[model samples]
Target: MSTPKLYAGLKLREIRTNLGLTQKAFAGKLGVSLPYLNQMENNHRPVSAGVVLALAREFRLDVTELSTDDAERIVSDMREALADPVFGPAAPPIADLRLAASNAPALARAFLDLHRAYRRTHERLASLDEALDTKDATLRPSPWEEVRDFFHYCDNYIDAVDRAAEHFASPAGRPGDPMRAAQEALAHQGVTFTRADGPWLRYFDPDTKQLTLSSRAPGSTQRFQALHQVALLAQNELLEATLDLARFQTAEARAIAKIGLANYFAGAALMPYRLFMAAAQETRHDLERLADRFGASIEQVAHRLSTLQRPGAKGIPFFFVRVDQAGTITKRHSATRLQFARFGGACPLWNVHRAFETPGRFLRQLAETPDGVRYLCLAREVSKPAGSFRAPVRRYSIGLGCEVQHAGALVYADDLDLTRSFEPIGISCRICERPDCHQRSVPPLERRLSVDPGKRGILPYEIGG
Candidate 1:
C-alpha cells in the first residue's frame, strides 16, 4: 500500500510563524521555492520528502509533527459533541467533519467550545442548587475538564517541565536514585521531611517548613509525593509560566492545572525521560520490569510510557487510561490516533473492564476500533491500600496499548497472531457507528433505527443503513 500524502498546512504555517520567518526566508531555509512553499502551506500540494529533510537539517524540527494529524483528535471530539440528543439524528457526515478538522481546525474548536458551553448551561439549569445560585452565574467548562483538555491537546507531554524534572533527577547529568535526589533537594531548601502514620499522604506546613509523608503509604507513593513537592518548591516559576501560556479562564482551572503540572513533574522525575525510554525499549515495555527498575508502581510506569512524547526522541505512541471499577475513565491520554471518550465510561467490550475480575495479572487483548485501527492492549488491576483495615482501598484498572504496527516492541504482544481476527470495540455507545454490538447501551445518534413490536435481535430496534 502506498503511503498517504501529507497535507499539514496549519502545522507548517505555525512552525514558520513561531520562528518569525517570512515566506521567502522560510522557503529558503526549507530549500524550496516561494511558490512551492506557498502551495504546500495552502495544502494545494503535499509536503515532499526533500522538504521534510530540510526541516530536520535547517530548522532542527521534529519531522513527525508535520504529520501528527491533530485533526483526528478534533474530529473525534466533534463526533462526541454531536452525539448529544439535542443535536437530533441528522448530524453532519464524517467526511465533512474531517474536512473541517483538517482545513479549519480553529473553527472546529470554536464549535466544540460553543457546544460545551451549551451543555454546561443546560446542566446548570437542570440542577436546582446551581440554578438558584444567582450571585455567580458564569457558564464555563469545569476546571477539571479544562485541565484535561489542556493535557489532551498537548499530547500529554510538557517539554519544559519534563526536562526540568530530568535535570532534578540527575543534577550531575547522570541517572541516580530519584527519591534520594528529591529528599536532598528539599533538605537544601531548609525543608524538614518526616514520615508519620496518618491519613494524609503528603502535606507541607508552610509556616513550619516541615513536609510530612504518611508512613503507611508504599515507598513508591512516598517517593512520588516527595518529587511532587520538589516540583512545587523548586520549579514554581516554570509551572507558573506554563500556566500563563495556557491562559485558563478561571482561577480554579489555573490552580488545578498547577497541581497537574506538579504531578507531571513528579512522574517525569521518578522515571526520567531518556533513561526510562531506554529502559522501556530494552525491556519491551514490561510494566513490572519497568516498575522494579524505576522504583515506581505499575500504574505509574504505564502512565509515564504514554508521556514519552519528546520532540526528537519519542517512544512508541501509546494510549494509557485508568478506569474505576464502575468503568468511568478517571485518567486518559493517547499519543496515538485512538482518542478516548470525553464524557461517560469506556467501551464495555474492552479488556480493561475485565481487569477488575482478575487482580495481579495482566490481561492482553487484540482489539479493533470501528475505524479499523487495531491495537495490542494490556491492562492490569491496581489496588492502593490505605494503610489500615478500616480504611478503604482505592482500586483502579490501568490500560496501556499501542497500535498493531508497534506491537512487536511490546513483551505482552508476544505469541499473539498479529494478522488474524480482532475483537471489536468502540469509543462510546452514543457515537460509535457499529450497529450490531450487543453490549451497546444506547442507539447511535447518527443512524436511523426501526422498531417492531414482534421482533427483537440483540437490540429492541434494528439500525438502518
Candidate 2:
C-alpha cells in the first residue's frame, strides 16, 4: 500500500493568512518558490515534506493541523446530505465529494445548509398543522442543529472556555474542589444557595439573588447544578464572548448555545482538563473509576472523555452519543473518524440499541463500518429519575467508543477478541453502501435497484452495481 498524498490547501492558506503574510513572503519562509506555494495552496499539488518541516520549525505550527480532519468531516456530512431521496439515484461519486470538501469547504458547507433548509421546509409542508403555523414555515435552520454543527465543526473543543474552566477548577496552580469554588463564587455574587423539593433540577431567582437546587437530586447533580449556575453568574461575559464568536444565525440559536456553553463550562470545571486527562490515562479510561474520581455520573464522564481534544495534550479520539429508547440520537460528538447519522437513529446493529434490554450492565461490541473502520464500542443505559414516583423518568443509552487500535487503553476491551469477526454497522441506511443489510430501513439513494418479483434475498429489491 502507498501513502496517501496530503492536500491541505485550505489549512495552508489559513496559516498564511493568519500570519499576515503574502504568497511570496509565506513561500520565502517555507523555502519554496511563489508559484510552487500557490500550487500547494490551490491544492494543484500536494504539500511537500520540506514545507511541512518549515511549518513546524519556522512557524511553530502543529503540522497535524494539515491533516484531513475538517475535510473528512465535510466529506462525511456531504455524503449524508446527498443520500437524500430528493437527490435521486445519481449522487455524485465519493471522490468528487472528497475533492469538493478538500478544495472548497465553504461551498460544501453552503450546500449542506441548503439541503438542511430543504429538509426543514419539506417537514413543515408534510404536516398541515405545522404548515399553518407561520413560525414553523420559515426556512431557518433548526437552532439545536445549528448549535450542534457549531460544536461539531469545532471538534467539540473550545480552547478559551476549557482553559478558563481549568483555571476555576485549579486556582493558583493547585487543584481545588470545584464544588467548593462554585459555592464560594455564588456567595461572593450575593446569591443565597439552598435546596428545596421542586420539579426542576436547578432554579434561580435573579430578582431575589437566590439560587436553589432540587433536594431530591443526587449529590453529583447538585454539584453540577451549582457549577452551571456559577457559569451563568460568574462566567457570563466569557460565555457571551464565545457566543458572539459563534455568530449563530438566529437569536434562538444564540440562546441555546449560551446554555450549551454554560453546560460545557460546568462539565469542564467539574472534571478539570489536566486532572481528568491524567486520571483517565492512569485508570486506562475506565468510566466507572473516572466517575468515582471526578464526582461525576457515568454519562458525564463519557461526555467529558470525548471533549479531550485539546490540541497539544490530546487523548485518544473517541465518539460519544446518547439515544433515547425510541432510537433518536439526543446528543452526539465524535473526535474520531466515525461521524454519527446527522438526522436519524444510529445503526440498529450497534450495541447501544440493546443497552435498554440489560438496564445496568455495560454492553460491548467490536463493530466494523462499511468503510472498514473497526471500533470497540461500549454502551450502558442511563436513567434520570424525576425524584418522585409520579414524575416521568427519562432513560437514555450512552455509547462511548474509540477505534480498535485504541482498544488497549480501555478497560472495557479486556477479554474481548479483537481478531474475531466484527458485527457490521453503518451511519445511516440511506447513506450506507452495504447492499445486503438485513436491517436496512430504506434502500440507499445512490444505488440503482432491480425489482425481482420472482425471487428475493435479504431485501425485496436488489441493489445494482
Candidate 3:
C-alpha cells in the first residue's frame, strides 16, 4: 500500500473560499499566476518559505497554521522531506525555492499547521492528566516559566535605549546611578513626566509621540516612570536580541519568546544587575531595605532579588511567586531547581495566602515537603493601581522564598523559630501523596477511598492506608 499524502491543498482552497476571493484575486495577492496558485492547492507543486510568509502577513494568521494546513502528520512529513538531500545539492536551489514559495505554498502551510496542532494537543493532554490527579491543577504551564526559560538560554541583551545611553555615556561609565541614567535616556526619547492630580493619569499621552508620566506616590513612583520610559524606548532591540539568542526555529515560538524577553530586559534595566546583586547580599535579601534603597516597591525588590542568578557571581537562589486572593498564580520565577506541580493548585497552608489576612503586613513561615525539602517563605500583600476614587481597588499577594539551608542569609529568618514544626506542604496534589492531609484539594492518583458519614474525619474523605 502507498503512504497517504499529507499535503493540505484542500485546506488552502477552503481558506481562499472563506475569504470570498476568486482564484485570480488570491493569486494576485501572492504575486503568483492563477494557474500556479491552483497547481499549489492541487498538490502539483510544493509550498515554500516566501509563500508561507505572505500568507501569514496578508491573512494575519500564524505562519505554522497557514503552512501546515492545520495538520500534524503533514508538518512532520514536510520536516522530514526538508531534511532529505534528494531535494537538491546546492544552496542556490533552496534559495530559489524560498523566493517562489508562494507558487507552491500548500506543502509548507500543511507542515507548520500540523506541528502547532500537535503541540497544543500534547499540552492539553498533559493538563488533563494533571487535573485528574489534583483539583487545583493549572490551566496551563506558568507563563513566567515560559518567559524565564527563553531568556536564560538566549544571548544578546541589546536594548536600543540602553545602547544609545551606553554610547552617550561611554566616556563616563553609563552614569553613576541607574535611575538617573534611565531618566536621561527617556529625555532623549522626547518622553517627559509631570505631576498629575490622580493616580489614573500616572502614565499619560502613551498614544502621542511624546510620552508623559504622572503619579501620586512621590519618590518610588518617579523611579518606575523612568523605568517604563526606558522600557518603551529599548523594547524592540531587547526583543530582537533575546529572540536571536533563543534561536527558535519556528516563527511562532520566536514571536512568543520575543515578548517575554522584552519584559525581562525591562525588569533587568529597572533593577540594574550590579547594584541590585550587591545590595541583596549585603542586606541578606531584606525586602524592606532593598525597596527603600532602590526607591522600589516591596514586591519589585523581591522580584528583582529572585533573578540574581547570573552564574558564578550569584546571590542566594530564590523563588518568587505572585497570586491573587482567588489563588490563581499569576507569576512564578525560580533560580533554584524547584519543582512546581505542573497540573494542580498550591497547598492552602502555604504562607502566601496568609498575606491577604494581614493586608500590608509581611508574613514569614518555614515549610517542608514530604520529600524532606524545606523552604523559608516570606509573603506580603500589594494593592493594584486604582482607576478612580469611586472605583474599588484590587489587592494581590507576592511570595518570595528560598531553601531552608540558605534561610539564614535572609533577614526574614532572623526572628523566626527555625526548629518549630511548621506545616508540611506539597507543590501540587497529584505529586503530593500525603494521606492524612486535610488540605488536599484533590485526591492522589490510584488511591481509592470513600467518606464514612458515621465517622467524619478532619477532611471530607478518608484515604486507605
Query: Which digits, one per residue and each the tens of the lDDT, describe model 1 over residues 237-299?
Result: 999999999999889999999999999999999999988999999999989999998899999
Higher lDDT: candidate 1 or 3? Answer: 1
Span of ten consecutive residues with least summed lDDT in model 2: 128-137
What does candidate 2 score on TM? 0.93
List of clashing residue pairs for candidate 2: none
Model 2 spans > 4 angstroms off: 1-5, 20-37, 47-54, 129-137
Error of 1 at 39 (Å): 4.2
Itemize residue pairs with steric clashes in candidate 1: none
In candidate 1, how many Å is residue 280 off?
0.9
* Residue 18 lDDT in candidate 3: 93
lDDT of 3 by residue, 425-444 (tens): 87666545589887777665
Cα lDDT for residue 366, candidate 1:
96
Better candidate by TM-score, 1 or 3: 1
Question: How many clashes in each candidate?
Answer: 0, 0, 22
TM-scores vs. true structure, each candidate: 0.94, 0.93, 0.61
Worst 10 residues of 1 by lDDT: 129-138
Over 4 Å off, model 3: 1-179, 192-208, 217-222, 247-262, 446-455
Worst 10 residues of 3 by lDDT: 68-77
